[model samples]
Target: MVGRLDGKVAMITGAASGIGLGTVELFVAEGAKVVAADIQDEKGAMLEKRFPGKVVYAHCDVTKEADIEAAVKKAKTEFGGLDILFNNAGISDRMSTITEITAEGWSWIFDILVRGPALGMKHTAPLML
Candidate 1:
């Protein structure tokens, strides 16, 4: 029997660790070519080594549109096309109270959690379709 993702190409942000890493593992196991993008270069490189030819890693700080754009371009160049995009890059502040959340803290969280995903989607949506 063939895997559900056989021959498909997928791009997953935040893929150097946690949920994103799990998704990348499963996608590759199911026979999809995967592009794993994260800001963590060392971890991403380790993941790429683990998966061999089935996976590629892009060092991307998702808060920047140019970085996200480069990741998408890498995906297309490496895998030929993109079929799935997992917008999973995010950061958490876990502030105890509104007063505890500094302006800079809020800005950082929003930049990572909201703007990052938005930029990834904006750059990758057209490529996926």
Candidate 2:
């Protein structure tokens, strides 16, 4: 049977665990090659082994623009081009309330939740087009 994503290539952030891990599995099962981007080296390495040629692991800290750029490049170099960008990396402040959160905590969350995806989209748009 022809999978819906046959011949497609995807880059998924936070891919070492949780939703991103699930997505990597789904995309691969549907015949899409994947670039699994995350900070968890061991888990990310496991993904490469689990999927072999269908998945490439890229060490991506979403807060860093260079990391995002590198992951996008990996998708292009490894899979030829990107058909999808799953900007799924995220985190939460450990503080109990917003008032308890420090400026650094806010910046960190903003970097991951907002700046990260924005950078992902910015870098990935050219390949998708």
Q: Compute each candidate's TM-score over C-alphas.
A: 0.92, 0.96
lDDT of 2 by residue, 62-89 (tens): 9999999999999999989999999999
Our model 2 lands, by Cα RMSD against the true structure, at: 1.1
| Candidate 2 lDDT (Cα, 0 to 1) | 0.94
Q: Which stretches of candidate 2 lie over 4 Å from their true place?
A: 93-96
The worst-scoring run of ten residues by lDDT in candidate 1 lies at 90-99
Clashing pairs in 2: none
Tens digit of per-residue lDDT, candidate 1, span 11-75: 89999999999999999889999999999999999988999988999989987888988989998
Query: Candidate 2, residue 119: CA error in Å?
Result: 0.2
lDDT, model 2, position 100:
83
